[model samples]
Target: MEFKRTNMCGELRSQDIGKSVVLMGWVGKKRNLGSLVFIDLRDKTGITQIVVREEDKDNYKKAREISQEYVIEVKGSVRERESKNSEIPTGDIEIVADKINILDSANTPPIYIKDDDDVSENLKLKYRYLDMRKPSVQKNLKLRSDIIRTAREYMYEHGFTEVETPFLTKPTPEGARDYVVPSRINEGKFYALPQSPQLLKQILMIGSLDRYFQVVKCFRDEDLRANRQPEFTQLDLEMSFANQDDVIEMNEGLIKELFDKYTDYDLELPIARMDYKEAMDSYGSDKPDLRYGYKIQNVSEIFKDSDFKVFSDNTLEGRSVRAINFKNLADKYSRKQLDKLTDFVKDYGLKGLSYIKYQEEIQSSIKKFLTDDILEKLKEALNLEDNDLVLIGADKDKTVLEGMGALRRKVAKDNDLYEKEYALCWVVNFPMFEYSEEEGRYVSQHHPFTMPNEEDIDLLLTEPGKVRTQAYDIVINGDEMGGGSVRINNSDLQEKVFEALNLTEEDIKNKFGFFIEALKYGTPPHAGLAYGLDRLIMLFAKTENIKDVIAFPKTQSATCPLSEAPSPIDDRALNELSIKLDKE
Candidate 1:
């Protein structure tokens, strides 16, 4: 009998044994014995077994001809499996086939449609359509979609209107390079793809779109890393008449809901809060992963009067000394391995890294140079134990924090100290400005539009580095999941910010004159945050590679192998835009 699919392949079980059903999917596998044939029908929902008996002559013969990936519709009745395959979710039931219809025939796929297939990324990308047939990839995409849906619903419930900002806008100098689009109408001019809807969202507050949010596409022309892509999606949001605390509370509810609904883990709301200075001093990272406990310890005071010149010199320069006490990892890493770790911190501009491994006899690099009193004090200060490995970095305060911060993570990973779970930390109290020695000026750490902490306004020009901003970042497992700041609303305060950044009158007029004009017409006190949606999905799906989350991700070189984008355009089209190609 011919039949339309009444149920998905995996939806049936032993309870539906006598119920007639039709199942349709690609043939995941096929096996033929002397007189009988068995096939596994696979779909996004799951897999089910189909059996054809020799007595059904024509149907049994047709099943013999079926191969992997052949799309077929099977009319059958569910039955208990003779041999239960406990590995799969629906392994207890089998579908006894009565008839089969081949819907579509497929060539043998270049890559296997199974997880743990050892195919090259290039091959997988080239045959991405076939590759996505794998259950693992499908599951990841579904999880990502669900996460976005939950986020949207949560925002709507909390009074946010989804609004889309423009894709093309003016290029600002501070952020990463922009992906520019050529203009035929304005021949020599170009429009830039937004790095984020930074300026536009702020302008919306002036326009009274009070609470706005968008799950939007953002672009940046930058080198890619394992978890970064040139074109990415962001959960962009802005709110009027809200302070840092207000934004934080709303986001906490959304995030806690996300974790509770999506995974088996229960994420604690009102998650632990860490300040910028505390995070840097303790972890050397703004986004500290709290799953592990190897917090950095300051040893500058204990090492100040030491005979070791490196420690003493660092202190004299107004820099600092710090260490991560890898409690039991001293036995795990050998001497040669420790030297390699020393070489690693040099990349972060630290002059050197020193370590002391406490054993039956305390082992160290500068052991001979240390007096008993100094050595004892150093050990006491660090709370060192017999099996602890102490890794130290010293230089400028910033360099010490940055270098050791990274070393702590490296050691944790090497020793398997990570919890393999989520820990969200809201890092706040970020300094509003950072001094640039090259430019001989101060630059906004977040952006110029970010308001400075009210009490610090007097020091904007005189002590720019000391001024903190009302900015916050939602960090999860060591990655900044989202960040934003309470924006500058008062026109006079905005000008004062520009002045502190060493922007001349001409510089201000050229880049952000229009934004200042918008502020004059009554802007509301507003704030918002944007989450790296792709990165958030990566976290929720527990995927290390960003490409796994994106459907048609570009390679590190920013070229799309599947569609062959960024290829040479037609000569006529290039000429129409009056473009020229330069060759070396």
Candidate 2:
């Protein structure tokens, strides 16, 4: 190039007309019209139009050969465009080229660098570099960077010290499966990746750091989903001498700042709060989407004496019967569509779904089994209207809630029932432990280190099922953006929690001996929260798939199409680590 760059392709404007400028970027698009060649020069900021007249013979020849994604440099004078484009910021001006230099040539990209390109996700992952060149993808990445920077600034201003924790540590039981790495020096021993810096952050509080935070990577060898990845980032923080209110207040300020600075929407301070039990009973989900109303209502008592076996038997057996009224959607769903809904609930382990269509007449598949009085009572209980459809689930508590919860979201999405741009709520007072059928024992609902509700301490051994904890989750639009709890600063209380979880002395010593020992060193009354950075970015980016917010993300199968990781290792490498793969 003859000249050093003076401005980005997207930086030129009408005010810069008559000023000489040098711009460097990739050829976004090119068109030749015999006498003039027009090129859309693109950099990270955006794209700008550059024109080369045939009168400038040498530059015109070079512009004619320019293709999409070709790296180039141009020295030109900015001029007001003859046709102003209201779409782009740089549309009011054009760069008249006095010089053009192609830095590199390129073959055609496998995927188009456009937001609406309808290509397979696999293809996008395979050519992610090209995919990232799209303005939309770049915008998402840029926003992610801005959010992280804002988070760091907020934490620092709040007297929180940024800290780094180990990526490799001793393997511990509970939570999700860990991605383990064999220690070459230790032979058969392996080190597990940190699921979260839960233990380390608590120890920092004990170490008297007072306040600590980290924007770090964590790994979990778990099944993939739309909002899940094998490895992801988290904004983890812990504060000593902080209670539940303190933690919530600090995070609320940070969230408010982020939204106000980056988004057009303003978040109301001190977001709404809901009890965990109320959330589940009303919305059938711990992380309930509050943007729209389709609240699940418990109708078990109303149906206790009903003739319908599905309803009566479950109610009589201490199970549940829940109903959701999809207002004025009776005609929207036909018999075939209702049957499809039944199949959807079946996927959640419900035997089937029962519904009542209230159109000109009250009609239901189970109407024959119900008496007129029972039907009338049900209609009143659900507040059914002339054109409303009520879907019902009857089963064990968990099954019923799961089925109805899924149906609520699905129906809302299918019918375009979203009423708000964002709904943020805090779900508090979660159960400390839940029965794990596979383990035939109780496991921590949040984690073993969580402090139980003080009043429920006696119930830990007496009525373990009734014990609640000081845990809280921040749910936004049906997704759990983050969750945390007051830690068990008392070693004795922590031991009792482990006992309730049925962790034997030996199990406790092996898995959490270090953490328990650390607590003995006068751990402060501390609480912290860790936000799923990817999930938070997803919400801000308005993207359904988590990968859209991530620069290089794995596919649903947990494999990187671009790098093709998780491939077979050489035998010699395994031998160095004293490891061998089990061949079936």
TM-score versus the correct structure, for each prediction = 0.97, 0.98
lDDT of 1 by residue, 1-584 (tens): 25767998778877888888899999999988867788999998899999999899888878988889999999888889999998887799998888888888889888899988999988888888888888888898888889999999999999899988888788776467989988888897888899998889999989999999999999989999988899999999999999999999999999889888877988877878899999998889998989898888888887888888899888888989888888887888888998898899998889898888878888888777667777688678777778888888889988878888888888888778987677789998899988889888888888899988889999997899899989999999999999999999999999999999989888988788888889999999999999999998998888889989888888888888789888888879888888988866
Candidate 2 C-alpha lDDT tens digits along 60-158: 888878888999999989999999999999999999999999999989988988989999999999999999999999999999999999999999999
lDDT of every model, 2 decimals: 0.88, 0.92
Itemize residue pairs with steric clashes in candidate 2: none
lDDT of 2 at 143: 94
What candidate 2 gets wrong by more than 4 Å, as runs, is: none
Q: Give model 2 RMSD, 1 decimal.
A: 1.2
lDDT of 1 at 277: 94
